[model samples]
Target: MTTWHCLSVKPEELRLDTTLNCGQSFRWVNTGDNQWTSVLSGRIITLRQTDDDILYRTPDDNVGHVEEVLRDYFQLDVDLGELYKQWRTDANFEKKAGRFMGIRILRQDPVENLFTFICTSNNNIQRITTMVNKLCQHYGTEIGTIYEVSKPFYTFPTVARLAHEDVENELRQLGFGYRAKYISQTARYIMEHHDETWLRGLRNLPYEECREELLKLAGVGPKVADCVCLMSMDKPGAIPVDTHVWQIAKRDYKLSGLASKTLTQKNYLVIGDRFRTIFGTHAGWAHSVLFTADLRQFEHRLISSEETKSNVVLEGTKREVSQARRPKKTAGVTVFDRYPRRKRQILEGKHGIVEKK
Candidate 1:
């Protein structure tokens, strides 16, 4: 039987259905009765919210400080109330806040965010979720299972694991399509030429520099890099403009030239800067909420019916790529496979951290 640890939280502060499945992180699966389960940072964790608190569960007995883990992962420290207040200053934000209230950006592992967003290129949420799950099932260590799906849960695969495995062809066979090569090459480059330190170090750099460095990887581009920046790294100002957001820029913000269709590199920057001007330092979070609401409202009208949300797509950015075959195996641990200790200081940023009494 799975053991659960409970953490008290205000009901008004968050809604699990909106936050978890809003198309940010893909691992968590909704089992039933509002409960969600996933293998995060190598441990199989499950959670659900009641009227007064959030309940977290895990099959592993040694999982320490579950409350702290939830705090960090959900970023409960960041004040959504204050953010909503700030965002409501804009008329459009005020109108949409009620419908999408309580949506929060997850603080996911940077490595996972990088690959996940890379897989996001020209893809939809369902396929992206499937690809990520496949990476975990094929290469990640098995953790446990949830009732919603028959397959046992597995941790997200690490760079070393994907780098060493015959991942490209395997991923192609698994229906990753063209993204299989991008995932394979990105993993190989990380394992061969860099380390986790290099990737995490990008966090400390300026957003522009970090985006540039990330673009050097096989399939990473402006949208993917900015996603890793805003979602994982501490830069909340990073606005990842995709087709949905682009339509928003035109329809809502009335940013001209976007109506002709397609996100050019120039228009991408213009839209991003316009959002920063409107939402201030935390434009990325604002973008997330707006995009979430936009996506929910405009589900059928999206560029591709399969398209979910997140990141940008430059019209002239696609380039030809050499095909990668399966490579020989080696032994090592991946960053995603190893769970690290939680940080003591949560980023309170605009609002002070609040704990349930």
Candidate 2:
């Protein structure tokens, strides 16, 4: 076991539970006990959080500069608390974002971010995660397994590896669907015409120029290009307005007088510009907090006062009643029982109510 080192960050400033799984980067696995494990760069890292610190460890002691890596990956230098204060000035943001603190934009590798998001076009988080894992397992360099979990992790594949002739067919076989061609063509284009440095060099360009360059890639549309721009290429103002965001704009922001109901190319740009206007320079970062609030999987986090009282009752019951004899149904249906099994587990875990089995 490696020595666990502490990174001092308030839970309000950075919540691992919310930020890691909030549809930004898809590789993190919730391995129970509030610890998330994933392969970042080439290192297998495990992280757990406390009230005032984030504890991180690697498989061994030789992983030099792990702290720096964590700081960069989590973008810890940016003051999220200050941003939250600023965003709260907007009534909509203040209303929705009360529980959704500590959400930060990850500074991902441009290469990895580009290809992984290529797989994300019109895809859900679960499927996108599966495709990205498959890509890494097949082509990426084998990083070692986690200590007790025994599951091996791999680095995101290099451009050369993903650029091979057989990669597209292999990806299709691995259930990449139509995204196989995009990944293959994008990889080959980069490998042939540009190097990883050139791709990363876009970080130095203005947001529009950076986005324009990304749009030249095979799989990159406006949304994908903007995703890369904001997430990887250091453009915090670039908002990728998908259907969810379009609804957010129309419903919450009351954006109207548009020509079409559908999110046209023109409307997409309009919505992004509107958000940038509302949230200022780090509008994309502010957009992520609201976006996470709207996700179904995270609805359990938004606990109400009534629910909290119910949870208190449930806790009291759990203590008074024996584990085996405890009533499965509290009142009509217990709070935990209302959610799906997976979300129930998450809620139960959060409330410190252990499952019977």
Candidate 3:
């Protein structure tokens, strides 16, 4: 049965333009009906909300299946409204945060979300987005050419298709850099180990257990795994604890005073343990909600640090080389106070994969 209900609104101020430049596309656009559409799922899906409920639709007639998947996967009925309200009231909630620039994190596919977080390590959002788009156009199934909406945005590559050894080399051709290897390894692991049936186990496992499993993949640190867990698996306390959040905890929460020494993962946990006490089971999601709220303040703090400048730590050369050509909007480069955002959107799908003939 096709049912339409109020799921959520795509906040206009935070809506992004997904057509032109996915790398630098983080601004909001008005859909003209006091609503906006987000090109999520590697540009395979778009979501908009009406006055009451959010409408989830694919580019095809598979809306029933897709809606069921979202309902079951996200557990949308589990006091989410109350949880959102609590998040809004928390002392740490940043004033403009509850909408999170209308990112619509809940709407993204779980598998893609997990894999995308893996690309986030030691990178920036622009570069990360570009890389993700590139992977899709090169590897994923084609939906159709919709000249009306987008010229075309491909679905994300399946784990089965990306498990090829050549994926590393192919992605490297797209400027994925070190993450090319990580993506290959992650693809290989999921393809070899995660059968279709295993997807069910993802829901049964405890959030910690699932996160630990994700961490086992190459290039997936605790922070990346935590982000995947919290955003996709409903791990309410699975705070990803990136550089910006780290600073907020220290400066605002005073969980730890600024120390002269280099901070370590254990140092992260010391403060995180405190959040566990304060935000409790919802701390993980709470951290995200607050992080979204205070993004301007957090961005101000992180962008002010010096290490945001690109410093390449060669895997084997053991040589530190200065970056050659840097992107213009490198605002997230200066994060010395925290672990630092690995700033960059994923590579675009067209790079190195689809060549102009």
Q: Per-prediction TM-score, please?
A: 0.80, 0.85, 0.66
Per-model lDDT:
0.73, 0.79, 0.53
Q: Write the per-residue lDDT of candidate 3 for residues 60-160, one digit (tens) a residue.
A: 53444555554443345455445555555556554534324233234345567766766776787666777777777788766664322454656677777
Q: Write the per-residue lDDT of candidate 2 for residues 287-325, one digit (tens) a residue.
A: 999889988987765545442333213211221212332
Better of 2 and 3 by lDDT: 2
Those runs of model 1 whose alpha carbons end farther than 4 Å from true positions after fitting are 1-3, 61-63, 146-149, 297-357
| Highest-scoring model, lDDT | 2
Q: Which candidate would rank higher by lDDT, 1 or 3? A: 1
Give stretches of model 2 more than 4 Å off: 307-357
Q: Please give, for residues 219-244, the per-residue lDDT of candidate 1 as tens digits.
A: 88888888888888878899897888
Worst 10 residues of 3 by lDDT: 348-357
The global Cα lDDT (0 to 1) of model 1 is 0.73
lDDT of 1 at 23: 77
